[model samples]
Target: MRFTTRVLLLQLLTVVAVVATSTAVFIGLSMAQLRDEAETSALMIARTVAAEPEVRELVAEEAQDEENPPAEELAQGQLQQYAVAASQSTGALFVVITDQNGMRLAHPDEDLLNLLVSTSFSEAMEGREVVAWERGTLGESARAKVPVFAPGSDTPVGEVSVGFERAGVFDDLPRKLLFIGAAALLALVIGLIASLILRKRWEKLTLGLQPEELVVLVQNQAAVLDGVGDGVIALDTDGVIRLSNGAANRIFGILDSENLTLADLDLADDVVADLEGGTARDGVVANGRVIFLEARSVDRGGQALGSVIVVRDRTDLMALSERLDSVRAMTSALRVQRHEFANRIHVAAGLVEAGRMQEATEFLHTMRSRGPVDYPLVGVELITEPFLQAFLGAKSLEASERGVSLQIREETLVLGNVAEVEDVATVLGNLVDNAVTAAVASDELRLVEVTLLDDADQLVIVVADSGPGITPGADPFAHQPKKLAENDQDSGQLKDHIHGHGIGLTLSQDMAQRRGGEVWLVEPGGEKSRRGAVFGARLPDVMEPDDSVNYREVQEEDK
Candidate 1:
């Protein structure tokens, strides 16, 4: 059967059982009460007859006789008349007067007069009263017995027995039982009707799906929600998170998402607005990660069902693109260096061809003393590390391609090699990249100046650009770009894949903050003469100490 049908059947059965049991108990109690009433009336009639003065006098006169007389003698006597009168008046089945010897003086049946009574009357024989249900010659009945006292005396001479026939005792009870049965039937009808209504409601609520189908649907939903790589957040119409899978929790770096709304989450305002408006947005930073989100409302038959957001993480992809940009910049610098070498070689060849060996030798010596100058960056010889040299060189070449003069300040100095070069690159590269982009967008002289300072084990970097400086007293990190749809003009690729205005900067700040450092704005740089924005960062424990243990050895040993 269908789910609702089975449920209705169960509910109906339950109601039926309950009503039936209650009706049965009520019938039992009613029958008991009727029996008690019957017995009480029978006892009251018996006592009334036993206390009758004429009936007592006659019974006493009969007891005075030494020999038992034939019941026919007193069958028409006053004792018989009283028994017959009491039986007729009270509607009892029989009213029998018995001597103390348990012999009946009068009975409804004249044939039973003078015979020993069949049912127990011992208690009544001792001058006491008794009431009970018993079976006698007249069949089962609610019977009572009471002792008769001699006229004006305390001695008991005889007893009076009164009985209400079993059938007669329950005369009105049939109507009561009939009413109870009718009520039970009505209750059953009501229960069935209620069950049918409930079944209809259940069908509507479940869309008429069977239990097995619902189970399969739930399993499918679980698989689809949990098996996907991208994060999915399902919300109710109230904007409360109803469902959040493992990927979503992991992406947001939270342990639970129960009952949390968009405002409850640590999301940027632009991200929140996109979610609330149900729009697709890209390159929004959340929890220091670049995530592209596509949000849309869910509805069915014009009923608003709420909203859903699919989040795609792009941080790793952006990082790879940045590395690719670095490689491309390095490649361009190599081409420039090769072209310069060719010119120098051409000059030497011309000197040698003219038989000026001395000039050629001096030129070669001068080149050797000049040291490696492949990088186009100014002051390339100040730093000794090969990685930083290549990195800054690539950055300078990149800046030059965009018409910006990228140079290290004259005061830049360092005491030791950068210990965590990758960390240094992550923080420094972001600041310099932002500065270069800002300088390119400036109306002032397109120049970006970088300075590096080493104090203890900390490395400080500052990048100033001739951009339209930040607003006064405004947080530079406050602005978030909702989406990046522009293409990289030079590379014929979507630049949104490689960068976002706030995303990279947030990641840089997070990495620095993890090491007890910070990135801050030194100068908003929109003053009359200042003309540009300057950003600074301090990264601790990134400098190699003079007497430090070998980090590589420890890593290898741990592995």
Candidate 2:
């Protein structure tokens, strides 16, 4: 059954039980009162008959006789007179007298006067009043007996027994009690029904609210927050975490996705300190990286509850801003160079016009060959040796300018037509650029190691940088993008903008992913090195010969 129905049933049954018990108690009390009243009325009638003067006179005359004459003679004379007078005065069924031995002395029926009376009458003749309700010769009756005394003496003579036919009078009380009991029972049933109806209505009204509703609301809200990229952490009043979305969990390194607790994440001391202090703070870390941490107090009903901590990855944001600054700088420098080049072209044109053709040709050749480095990083087959030499040489210069030493430890392997030459260059260029930037702050021994190896199945390029290693924390990619700053004017501001660095790493990571490879940090550990970061890029090698290749052959070649 539904919960509301069950509750209604329970309440109805409880009401019914209480009503039933109370009704039974009331009926019992009424019956007892009725019975007492009936008995008292019967006794009063008997006493009234016994106190009559004629009834007393007859008893004294009976006592004067030596032998109480046979009841037949007394019934025809003195008993007749007493019975007529007493019955007339008192509204009794019959007035009968019995001697000490229970022989009827005077009776309303002459024939019964000769019959011996029951022991109850003999007991009554000995000066005891007896009242009984029973089925007698006159049908259902209430009978009472009172002893009579002699006129001038204190001696009892005979007993006067009065019986009132009570099938009507006595039955009146029980009938009325029965009517009362029936009415009470009906009222109890009606009250029980009304109570049940009210209880059911109340249960229906309360059905909409349940504890599970709260749980569902919480889960849905948390799921929506999880879809956001920014890290969000909510806590209760006891400094315990109540909600942590995916972004927050990633930023804090909390592993359990289903059941998470505050103590399991092990947040950094700085972050925890800010949380406890209940104040918003932003600062840079020792790694030349910037982090913005904000703490806001949560409240309910004007009472301070707990605090929420939001942590944002600002590394990319700072980098993009720096890139914008660099672009502006490069634009200004290019403008100056453009003006200088225009003047030189004017001077060179004058020389050619004055017939110094050799000098003019040489100047033109130098200008054509000495342009900025421009080459497609992907989708290329064979290149001119001069172009190759210039490109490689420029990469070396670029590394040196950034305070980084870059070296190719091994010769590049040609993986046949299956390997896209331009793709290789693009992947390597990005990786090398990132390595150089990361190692810029390193000591004299700062070096970026680049290695390329090709096997039957895949070509692997490894770029290792000598710098502070990647910290152990949550996965950055798993979280959604943070909300864009309201004051930001550029689309790049929505990206992960760290405070200190440029956008090289984030751009390189995106390129790596697009090429169907992953960029991961490996802890450089051994007796030779304390710690650094190594990033590896693996791409499929799909070289094919003139003949078809089998799976077994490919496996054997890979081995």
Clashes of each: 0, 16
List model 1 lDDT by residue over 389-421, tens digit each: 667877887788888888878867665677876
lDDT scores of the candidates, listed in order: 0.77, 0.57
Q: For residues 3-98, could you state the per-residue lDDT of candidate 2 as single tens digits?
A: 555666776677667766777776677656655665566677667656767767876676676775765577677666767677667666776776
RMSD of 2: 14.0
lDDT of 2 at 62: 62
Candidate maximizing lDDT: 1
Please identify model 2 stretches exceeding 4 Å from their true place.
1-234, 241-259, 265-269, 279-295, 307-398, 408-410, 413-434, 437-446, 452-460, 465-498, 501-516, 521-533, 539-559
